[model samples]
Target: MDKIVQFVQKSEHNATAVAIFGAIGVAVVALKALSFLKVLVDVFLRSGINLKKYGAGRGGWA
Candidate 1:
């Protein structure tokens, strides 16, 4: 759409605003993924079983 293109052009011209918006977008996605992971961990913990048995291996990093 013309309006969408215009908006993108406008945003591109404003470096600070673009950076702020990009940071906000990344933060929102990170928070959502973390929340989902938390829920998954809670569910697995409640099941009283080791997730490793399901072929999930431990990472080398601490």
Candidate 2:
């Protein structure tokens, strides 16, 4: 992390550009984490309609 900070500080890139790119990267990672959490909650905590009640294995559409 120190190396990264040094590189960014020493590079010729504009500060605003670096800040914008960093913010975009952070937003992407955060959104991905939130999406994964949502999937986990849906899979483990949420309940779905009972397919058996709709005759799922009897050839009728569930």
Evaluate residue 60 in candidate 1 and report its C-alpha lDDT on the 0 to 100 scale: 33
lDDT of 2 by residue, 10-55 (tens): 8667556788998999999999999999999999999988888878
Candidate 2 whole-model C-alpha lDDT, 0 to 1: 0.87
Model 2's TM-score against the true structure: 0.67
Q: Give the number of the best model, judged by lDDT.
A: 2
Q: Scored by CA lDDT, what does every candidate get? A: 0.79, 0.87
8-48: candidate 1 lDDT, tens digit per residue: 67766665676788999999999999999999999887667
- Angstrom error at residue 25, model 2: 0.4
Q: Model 1 Cα RMSD, Å?
A: 11.7
TM-score of each: 0.53, 0.67
The TM-score of predicted model 1 comes to 0.53
lDDT (Cα) of model 1 = 0.79
Model 2 spans with C-alpha error above 4 angstroms: 1-13, 57-62
